[model samples]
Target: MNQTDQLVDLKNLSPDALVDFLEGMGKEKFRADQILRWIYLRGVTDFSEMTDLAKSFREEISQRAIISFFTPETIEISSDGTRKFLFRLCDKRSVETVLIPMEGGRNTLCISTQVGCAMQCSFCLTGTFGLERNLTASEIVNQVCAVRKDYSVDNIVLMGMGEPLHNLENVVSALKILYASKGFDYGPRRVTLSTSGLVPEMLELGQRIKVNLAISLNATTDEVRDELMPVNRRYPLSELMQACRQFPLAPSQRITFEYILIRGVNDSQADAKRLVKLLHGIKAKVNLIPFNEHAGSAFQTPDENAIRAFQTYLLDRQIVAIRRAGKGLDISAACGQLKEKLENKLLGSGKESSLQGK
Candidate 1:
């Protein structure tokens, strides 16, 4: 059977499933560990690179199954050393991933979980594109593996193109792969999954995985939240807050509330006070991401003084707040700026050709 026809995302399969598949193919069970190491640890795309395996075994594996790793079709490095990658998926759908180099020897890989987004958040460009498809578990894992091959990733942020909790199964599967000792082995503390408050999945994730949770709580009030993020309308602020309070957290672990600082929108002192009330009793940190303006986006970043005042209010009230510095804006690959430009090019061409013929 052609491996591609198997419909198994090798990255998604558990270690036992991988072993079973290899053994069923008449390959030694020990080869499973080696294959997993190559795919996850070494990030090898071609079977030929599995030098530990015998040539004949490699050839057989190559004939039967192939590893898939996305190569960056476009790479852009910001002046500050933040690198953005536009990766081409196997199905020709493109997604963006970013590597942000931080101080003290830390690097974070921002990974996407879907081709486009279904959340339709008013502030997010990816949501404007509409839902394309959920990336396979392997596809999600491959972003980390492929990017880490070039950069030493010390942390991961599921804050790219799509709403991760919306693609819960694949997200959890990828998280398991990352946590697996036989694979990447990244500790749960090193990974953060951000969601626009998908309540059911949030509860499920809290039970299944212990990774850090970042909620895109752009607004504190239900009326404002509904205006900013449509997902809020379905899962109201009260219910979402209840879910967060119920979400299991270690004594030291605190949920991260990501609030995009859109000028004149949710930046007021009143909003900050309301936010404090909303987050009452739950251990949480606020990430104040100043809006990174993208073309056609209706929002604008709040001024420095306003941001400082907002931070000061949170700090005075004992709410931990960190300002997320703007990065990768030059490449339009920063937070909330991942619309597939190639698709837009194709659409534009179609329109031009149609006009010419008419």
Candidate 2:
């Protein structure tokens, strides 16, 4: 086989899979652990830099296994320290990853699971592109690999361009690598997978892995939800709520229900009360996101008073509801706003003003 044909991307393998692959190469499983630390912890791509590995073994492994990373074609930095990275895939399709600075010194890396979305959530701009393709396990994991090159990612959210549960297999494998002690070493608390109410896959994901689960629950009733999220039609509020209740969450970990508050749509006192009623016994918190208006989307951001009133109503009922600020608002990287920008390329050195039509 040619050299390129023999090479396998080490980043794509889970800890167990990597060990098995190394064993196939006549190396001990412990070698996989050492290589994982070198790749993830040290961010060293060159096999020669793994000083502990014997020189001859390094040459053999380097010939058979490869570390693959694709740098972002463009990066847009926000004033609030949010960095949006646009990475062009090998197929020429691209997806965006956002690094959001949290209140503390840590940063949250928001990565995509699919090239586009099939959910067709009315408010989400990504769905406008339709489901181009599901990302590979390597593609999903490499998004983190690309970002960690410059920033320390304390938290990772599979809440970017597509519905994570749609690409269940690849997404699960990527999560396994993320939580591997020798890989990224992220615990359940540090990683979250947000789904657009895919009932079966949500439960399957809970069973397969222990990452935090967040549901993109926009409306309280099925009628309103059907108009906003098409997936609600398949798994209505009743089925979805039942699935959430059945979800395996740690005693300390609560499922996050992401409710995007849209003006004159599903942002009312009655809606808030119904939300409280819906989440009655379920261990969940409401992440209230005021709809981030983008081009082609008719929805408007709710008034601050309206947003606060919604939160206050939930708070009064003893539910934990927090309003999430649109961190990358200025750079079109906030919630439900990665629209036509997907077709355009931001030129120059990652400046917001450098936006040019593709």
Candidate 3:
């Protein structure tokens, strides 16, 4: 490895890679598990604090390796107890991570896989920045480790700034470490990756990672989806649905279809019926997310009646449907509201509020 590369971020290496590094240093390979437990499960980032290792060995590791983590630039907490963390990466780029606390003491962390998104979904705020860069596997897992250092995180959702499938390899590698018993020890069922209908990579993810899959299916028709999510123009609804039907799902695992209910857009009775038909064969549940408006966005959240009617339509049709309550609306931490404040800074506008009451 080059001199720069030799300053390896130990958090970036997988269990096997850790073992390889130990073996190369003439140390026992089993020490990799000890390190993994300290760094991942225990949220210990300092090698010197891993007291189980010999003092000399720890010194050697401290010199050769680094536990890299993003610098938390800003942390905002809403009245509803949702916390949003904006992390500044090594390249000085920023990504947002959200912690949504549920009623049953479940804390689900929504982490970013990229700095900004390439998928220009008309309603999303992150799409405004276009593609910045894909986050490395270490950067991805670092969000979890960083968050766990403060909060007890039980679930993880790849529903932040970027489309995860757009950076498939890094995401998959991070998932391996997160799922491994020697690492984060998070079960596959607790980890969910949401996508904007990247069919090929979605299929590949199913075959490779056993984590839960959630697809952002905002619009029912291809014409509408083409306009809302430009990715739909490439992977149309028919092809995406077909791929979903064929996806290798583990026993009792059902795909989650996230339907954002935009006012006068995709929340009509007819749209609800079509959504049911579209998800006819797939073992899926619909999460009806009422649009969370941000600064400079034209979309409006559907009325409560409209949202209820749409969800009711699916429920009556015997399809499992849930109207997802907007979390951290006051803090702009809900879906698509992240990064609006940063964009405001870039645009030189002092307008800060992103909450538009439903």
Predicted model with the maximum lDDT: 2
Q: What is candidate 2's lDDT per residue for 1-358, written digit by digit as tens? A: 5677678889878888899999998999899899989988888889999999999999998888888887988787889999988887876677889999999799999999998799998887787768879998889999999999888999999999899999999898898888888878999799988999999998888888888899999999999999999998899999999999999878898999999999999999999989999999999899999888877778999998999999999998889999898888988876435434644434333544212333
Relative to the true structure, candidate 1 reaches a TM of 0.90
- Candidate 1 residue runs with Cα over 4 Å from true position: 1-3, 7-9, 23-30, 48-60, 336-358
Listed in order, each prediction's TM-score against the native is 0.90, 0.93, 0.92
* Model 3 worst lDDT run, 10 consecutive residues: 349-358
Candidate 3 per-residue lDDT over residues 1-358, each given as its tens digit: 4575769888777777788988989999789989999888777878889999999999998888988766576788889899998776765567889999998998999999997789998888778768879999999999988888889999999999899999998898898889879877899999999999999898898888788999999999999999999999999999999999988888798999999899998989999989988998899999999999776888898888998899888999888998888889888876546565754463465433222220
> After superposing candidate 3, which stretches have Cα over 4 Å from the reference?
1-5, 342-358
Q: Which stretches of model 2 miss by more than 4 angstroms?
A: 1-6, 335-339, 346-358
The sequence of per-residue lDDT tens digits that candidate 1 reaches over residues 1-358 is 6548764456766676678878887877788788889888877778888899999988876766667677786677888788888777765667888899888978999999988889988888887778879998888888888888878999999999899998988888788888877678899999999999989989988888789999999997898899999998899999999999999988999999999999999999999999999999999999999988877787998999999999999999999999988876676665546444544554576732111222
The better candidate by lDDT, 1 or 2, is 2
Better of 2 and 3 by lDDT: 2
Q: Distance (Å) between predicted and true CA of 319, model 2?
A: 0.2
Provide the clash count, candidate 3: 0
